[model samples]
Target chain A: MAPEERLIAVGVSHHTAPLEVRERLAVAADSIPTLLTRLRDDGFSNETVLLSTCNRVELYSVPGVRGDANGLARWLAETGGVMGRDVESTIYRLHDQAALHHIFRVVSSLDSVVLGEPEIVGQFKKAYRLSQESNAAGPVMHRVMDRALAVAKKVRTETNIAREAVSVGRAGVELARQVLGSLEGRSALLIGAGDHGKVVARSLLGYGLTEIVVANRTFGNAVNLAQQFKGSAIPLHEVERYFPRVDVVICSTGAGKILIDRDQLAGAVSKRRGRSLVMIDLAVPRNIDPGVNDLGGVYRFDLDDLAQIAGRGKEAREVAAEEAERIVESESERYWRQIMNEVVTQRIGTIVQTADAVRVAELERLRSTLDGLEPDQVAAVDAMTRAIVKKLLHQPLHQVRTWAREGEIESVESLFTAFGTRKEDDV
Target chain B: MGSVLTIASIVTILVPVRARRLAQKNNAPGGIAAHRNWEFVAVGLILLGLLLMGMQSDVLPMLTVQGGLRTLALFVAIGWLVLRRKEKMAAAGMILLPMAAVLLVSSLLEPPHAVATSVGSPFFTTHVALVFLGLGGFALSFALSTLFLIQRRRLKRKQFEDIGQLPSMETLDLLNFRTQCLGFAALTAGVAMGVFLLTQSASGRGLGDITVWGTCAVWFWYAAGLHARVVLGWRGRTAAVFGVVGFGSLGAVLTVVTVVFGGWHGS
Candidate 1:
């Protein structure tokens, strides 16, 4: 064999770290190639994938360096510009089967902040593509990712986990409906032209929204999206100006800075005159400021709050997730077995090839001695030697295969060494 | 042989009871298989009855009380298949098929009188066929309404047990209305033919008889329900409630006419 290689994963996710730490660690899309190259150049791993999303930043690798978990953690902390900043406490390292199980869980959305959400699969696919393009993802990663994706698809199809809407937009709309009773005749203001903003607007329309106002940094983009929903468009700066006329506000802008602060929203709340104002901030850095929630009659929710609303229907999904986890476990076990079998088969093939080389050399050395004898005598001697070799090798080969299958790799390796067939010898 | 077939038909119809219980337990494949088998066997038994009656003579004696109920059950089975093609109506079938079995078996328990031979008039045969067929249609409507109400309650509570397989409330309402319309037309013609035949045949059972009055009351109630549904645009829960009440009143009238008045046509 090719020396025992294993699947490994190291990561920091929503469960282990706060949003402040996650935001700092989140890798930009363009920097993935450089990070992957660094992972290879620095001897972190032979096959690596850096999965950076809003809720998590995970690195999956194969043929991982032994006893280098702490080193890898320090490298990741340094890359995220948080070295010596206590980021080490939040990092986790997994190896072998635990690493495989972790990847399955992540792909199936069982490890997601919103349990059973579908966005993580697409995010993981993007990370896979990045690693493939950078040539950091080798054959092992290719197999692991392909199998992980298949497991994710099977979980989605065979379970009810993906049936419910677990998006921030859907949850925010549900929360608004609960507070306001009905969405009929309700007006909503979409404060960004982003996809998530459109999702919330669509959810509002599904609830019987009468009107929608779209506002974006680019006024033309706002108008383009507004036409689809049959809503009006406004410039980004003029968003708060129309908030008083709308019942709900959804914000998901690309700007990393907070767009709606308390001072700006306080005036808007005053304009509403004690009417309930439901504002949802779906951006990573939060487009709407937290301080806006303190104002009277203004209900502000960030991604965390949306996660809570999404959990309302989680009991049903929990049952499905359990079933999905079982599928993952079974599939992963099968894949691991297949990998071990392939390794054992390749080792046996090498041993057989070396034995053939030794038999050919011994027969050539005896060719001159048989020249003086009759052709029939030479043929008989050749047949006797072949039969002796076959009979002698059969039981030992069978025992080695059985040992390999029984997970006694050490015994099989020692057997190959004892036979002196582990190396290439011409004689 | 006829009694044996009737019992077999009843047994076949009761198969849906087991099928429905299996469905509720989430064994959908097993439930579906049992339901399909039940449909085949029940329809076969009813057809066998018709065939045996025809085997006895050129003019069959299938207008008797037991034979008429068997014929009604056959029509209901056909209706079930037709509506199933249009929508998911397993819940309606689950309730309606077992009731058809009970009624068919009950009809068989009546004393073996030669009522079919006594009422040998062609008009009497037509009246019995039409009325029982109408009753079959109304029973289907009643079953659909019951399912509609159940589904509505489940939807209101957001508890979706077997909701994926059951028909929607709207589909059930539409089907209930259509079946009621068909039943009303059939009942009207049957009652009209009976009255005309009574006048011409010199049967002493006239308008004064409680059976005739009860039949008239049943006709008028259905006519009103149909009229309210089409003309007043009454639908959903109102139409569902109306269907249940209309079918119940007609059933009560049927019991009184058969038991108390001793069945005006032949008994």
Candidate 2:
């Protein structure tokens, strides 16, 4: 009814927009309902759905697009409360088939914060459901989303996209535990309350450690962490006091300098009789010296050093991934073919409706002539005529479908060209 | 079976090596893919080799065939490890493949030799199986421990992100401990079964050995070690130390029983 429509995306993603622009245009989920309503009311979006994740903010729409696709551009500029030129500098516009394929790829987690992550599937489902509820999706958008979701499900179940490495924090705690095996009666001193460091602290606690002490440069952050873990919140000034008692030290402060150098850790471990101290340096410039690893039982894991150890089982997982990709590709192809069939059905209905008028008049005349004819014979004639019409339409419809697979309009144009047709009046 | 195995071995190893080298030379982004294909080759080789060594023993003088099979497997296992040096599974896999190769080959040297006690008993056969299973588990744990140590060393230098391709240290470490615990549990089962077999053999057929007693004692040591590691929170280098000691004792018991006591428990 809306005519066969083309889908398009005009937006910014983490790849296209730098952090500054991405944060600027990042529409919160809570405000999406009102924003979307305002957009549709502005008459630029015949169909609208917004994918607003931390990594990206995409606007999917169906044409007839308003004002040469510049309308959505203006809308984005307005919504972010920025100038059109600034938005244009960072925005990317993908047209028709590319837009549809892009969304499909995104849902598959090909464009994720971490490659092969599982979170994108849940995000895509939530976005689709929200748009559907908002009454912002038309028949075409609904079909595309349903197909995209199916592809996402297929990719996850069929491929190794969901397999994950241990989080960075988990890596820190594991190295510490491996180096100094017994932590049952040991004390762990934690610094920095970054998300990564918190995960490390949690892992250590889970491994059945006795005491955890929190200390951060900002005393409040340390206190908050200590409160959460039900541990001692020592003053930042006394960070060195707790270091000697802690058998394991995990540091992840944002400060540039070494929080605990080789000398500081040596002093602590020596006071404790060189009793197998594990020091984890999670700071960027490195909180602990690389030389500290040479000391007996003083194992230090820095970010750059963990790579060789992680390569072991990666080969096996990569093997499983190939098998998975073949499955997703085949399913995506099948879904695209189905969408083409629906489009063909729309075209066939229009052609048949015009034929129906002539056919009904001819059938009425035949019925009067065949009043003496048997009911079975009359029914056979009706079937024969219907079959003729179907046969006549088959070749053109097949060609149109083949073209639809390439893009929606090629075969239709070819069919129009075949009859030496140029205008709607000619049809 | 022999021909199939030999061909499979060559194809699996040789083709994969060449393919990997080619991929590396090409700077193929599919370098990871080349390594995966190598796994298929490895699986094929191992399965075929194991089957060949198994099927050859039915009619022949099993001892000769068994000894020959063991030697071949041991060599190939080590070779496989060296070839896939970059493979993370290679370390633990190296120990497993060789141990299996040696044990299977030796077991066939005298068919059902475990049951050759003074009196026939199912308990003895069960005990022998339990011992091998435990030993295999321990071997796996040993391999995992080695992997854990290597991973730990890399992590200390802060090279994880730089290497970009390795599995995380946390995962390898966890896998190592879990495997160690598994090995320990199997060893405990081995001890239980051996004690049961010993009592039954003594009461019924009256066969006894100091090595069997020693093996039983080693089992307890491993059981205690595992308990400390799992519950008492013994970790990392400490766990590796225990594994080496426990596995070494088990190895010593095995050597004593095999080389010193040629007395067959033939079924």
Candidate 3:
């Protein structure tokens, strides 16, 4: 009989648990090998793979899934320091078909916090690589995961999933417009001249924002930037000086200290007679302090924090998201059906082999009894015997095929395993 | 028997491989005409339809085979127009092929001028053949000229878009002049054979006749355009416009003459 295959996906993720749980479960980049080994030792075979991201962590294994899932759930709870009740409830367990569906969803960006975000695909590929390096991926998981990535790619290319959404920079500008309510005669202050900052500045310029004042660390550089876009330029030192005059402060600079702190911003707001200020900090270290987010008449968002206002993208991308989901479901079903096909094929091979052996023995016995036959007669008998075998096998093979297509292979495979004399071989 | 003869005819036309090479090296990469992928299918259908003729029930099979050929041509043009993305020429080809197909079908149904009288009819048949072949050649030149004209306009205006995908101008001009020369040869042959057929008939043959003179006039018009293209260094819009006038004259003579005669070859 053919070998059995099982797929298990057990890990903590945002959908499965809180971010705290997922953070603990995340396999660090450097520690992937050690984690893979630990999981393998605890009994995940060569088919184990770890997919860890900031928002989710998922482990996929093949060939004995539900049983393997229990082992993974226990291991994760102990290692990631989640309580048993939390592990039991939050650690989402999926076996065989469900594991495939989950992988498809993750790759399609449906499971991401921001729907239709293009980042998850690259991240998933990197995770698959780490699993490969750790020798934790086998044929079944490999095929399923490869198809998952393929489905995600097809969705992005064939549908408008990626382009329909607003970019983070544009979203920031939209938020600014929302906060200011109008850009009529309001001067927007653009700090730094980076790619993101320039994009937001241009988007602001597109929305009837002509009185934009630009300030950078390099004053002449700021003037070069300003003249190119027909906006006023300012000296970097006079950035805070103009803060009182501008209605909106869009800071995206590389200052080590807090460039737009609450105290300095408060003075600017007081001077401007409590006029609203929208600060879009698209920097890693954060150009504006997070404390300013709650300040009166102020709306601030850092690079990571941009996604919340990026909901405009969600509204735009909803149309494409439905199509992407349909693609994922179809591809996921195809993968599982292929898996079931393998199950049927394995059993069919064993049955055909056994039947052929028995028939060949009986034919040999019959040939000896008909030894008086001429050479051509013997050859004809041989051809007839082979044809008889073919006739006998065709109906059963066709039934097996029909069973495989309809997903009745699991029951039929168990029957074959019971009938076959060799239960010891690897499948 | 007819299939064998048609096969022989095609082999005779194609034996040098020079004519096929000449056709390809001229056409650009926008359409099936350029690729010549239908070399096997087009020739194969001709052989098949010819083979079917007279080897079976005559009129039904003849009309059926001809109908199939028309359908094949239409399908080929559509595939070229759509999958090959050569919409303009396909539209133009569509406009011309049905005319020849309709005349051929009607001739087939009516015994093509009575077989008992078909002896002298071959000359007139050659005339009909010349008209159709001339029309085909003119269509080819027109397609090339239209492309060249578009490219020329785009160049003059410094507007690169909407120019038909075609060979470079030098290539297109050469193709236009060459195809005009071929059609001129065929039409000249038609006019000569047509005069021969008129004289072979029992009726008094008049060479200086008006309609006969009209066909003669078309011959000179094409010959003059050919001279203008080759010697006068006329090119681009001027050459293309002249070719259009030449083809138009030939078309007018064929239509008006055929209508007067009731049809080409009196069939």
Candidate 4:
């Protein structure tokens, strides 16, 4: 690799692409090894890691001799069975420090759809692990990934970016807690076993809810969902029978009509004898009547309400994310400088080694002349020659380091060439 | 010195509110930590103010309205510090701190009243101390109950702007319950003491005085609320409402006795 060559990242994320375009280029975990090998074998990159998550599909790479970002972008589009022109608008290419900043933000979840969701970090680690196992990651990729992980850990510990719940399901759980106080001995009655309801139910279960009664239109589906939570499944008609028993009722069915009305909820409230009940209606057509909110001791929230709560959480995380962004920016600059310094050190070492080889060859040629001197005088002569070489190279090496510090990579490279060092010597 | 320290405490407590607002605007770091550190400073200032008031007073400070207000501010500040340690009751500070500042200012403005005629009696001193302490507890409970109502309203209406700053409704309800219970217990004891003192005294004062009856009415109101909570399992909105009204009546009774009767304790 050229001394000036730096890390680059290219692909589409939720920020740049719509779901349709992203799904077209999404690589599955089982196909990661194959795609990585193809990228290397086809000269798309010398080293690369493909991160494919629901929100983003990215390629982090040290560009190969034959490939630049344009070539990599085209290859990415083709690999996903799409034409280059189809995704050209959605693709983003970042190089050097920008690439480093992007990776750090991504690993820290600063770029997530839900501000500080944690799944992205695990996805990044898995992508990196796959790259390593496939022998696709080189020393530069390894160093970048390692530093990115450390930056992520620092951001998480130093800031409160990930402390709030910004997702809809988690926000529902938060609202439930706000209403019911503690979920330790509380029970929930899930009216539908659909995906959205399942997500909310899972969050409730995670928060120490003791019992979950799943009531679905299909009895077997309800049974399956309830069995997963170690709770009972009740028939759809029996939802009211179990309603007064649970602290929370989650409604997410496809029912077009109101399943529970204000009067029925009032009756249940009377039965509960003053304990507060939370009614979370996650259904699209509105499973629970909106009028139920007017009844005392009943806290009712729909999808919009949960979204509002989640939006507030997003606002809180945004404040914390401002601090996390600063950390990522500073760390990226520091790591970039460290990488440059390593390159400078390697170049300096090569020049000194070349000079030393010449010194040794000349000393062997003058062996007979040195034999006339005593052992102590010969040792002194060797030491004096070594010191002379070091003094002669010191000024130029110092200038190289200065150029490196000033980010004058081309100047540093020219200095290496002026010293009769070849490109292959860098490797 | 005590008045100055109390003023300083109020200023210190407002620092967190300013920091929080600035943080929301500028996306700045350290607001949370600043809030926490300034709360400690405020607590320290209030503590010093209380100590100075105690040292400067000739007799027990609770004998005068000025001294009583200062003592109430001290109790509320101390109670806030303790409750905030365990829950996100920072929103309570928005109500409690300003209330304390008002009490302190009122204390500064009011002239020191003559010491109670029964000041020499240990029983009178104890009764006055208990009443003021009970008032302090009720003051804290009032703030908590108000926050509970606001939070409950926000949750019920789903208007969640800046709602994250308040503790969960459950936490607020629980804290409100505890403070109301504390206030109720103190007031019960203090009322019992007043009854005993009235019976033993030859000053012609009796339990039938309007102020005494008002105090008893306030006591009965709290007694019913607490009974419903413990025995009838009342909680949340009902309990918070009871606390709010209980404190309001207690405040009215004190106001009537001070302004209309022209003396403390129906003199």
Best by DockQ: 4
**lDDT (C-alpha) at residue B68 in model 4:** 77
Which candidate achieves the best TM-score against the true structure?
4
lDDT tens string, model 1, B98-209?
A: 7777667766865443352326677877887788778878988999888876765543333444444666454577788889988888888889988887777655666567
Please provide, for model 4 over A200-228, each residue's C-alpha lDDT reduced to its tens digit, 9 standing for 90 to 100: 88899999999889999899999998889
lDDT per residue (tens digit) for residues B39-107 in model 2: 455555655554565565542222233333333344344434543453444344435544544454454
lDDT of 4 by residue, B1-267 (tens): 777887788788778767766776787635656577787788788778766766876666667777777777777777877877865666677677777777777777766674556776788778777777787788888888898899888887778885666787777778888888888888888889888888887877765577678878988998899899888878888989998998889878877776778656654
lDDT scores in order? 0.75, 0.60, 0.62, 0.81
lDDT by residue for model 2 (A94-154), tens? 6655566678778876655444545466667777777887888877788788888887777
Off by over 4 Å in 2: A1-5, A63-70, A82-89, A164-326, A358-395, A405-408, A413-427, B1-267
Write the residue-wise lDDT of candidate 3 on B176-265 in tens digits.
Answer: 777777778877887777777776766554553456677678778877877765665565566777777766675576556545654333
How big is the positional error of residue B98 in model 3, measured in Å on the Cα after superposition?
79
Question: How displaced is residue A111 in candidate 4, in Å?
Answer: 16
- DockQ, model 2, C-alpha based: 0.07
Give the better candidate number (1 or 2) by lDDT.
1
Deviating ranges (above 4 Å) for candidate 3? A1-5, A63-67, A166-307, A361-392, A421-427, B1-267
TM-score per candidate: 0.53, 0.42, 0.43, 0.60
Q: Write the per-residue lDDT of candidate 3 for residues A1-427, one digit (tens) a residue.
A: 1233366787776556764465456555677778777666655554777876656777887633223566677776776666577566787778667778888888888777667766678778988898888777767667877888888888889788877766555666655654454466767788887556776778777777758888988888899989877888988778888877776677766453467788877777655543456677764335677777556445575544456555535877888888888888888788778767766677677777887787788878887776889989888877887788878878867876887687674655555556573422323
The TM-score of candidate 1's chain A against the true chain A comes to 0.80
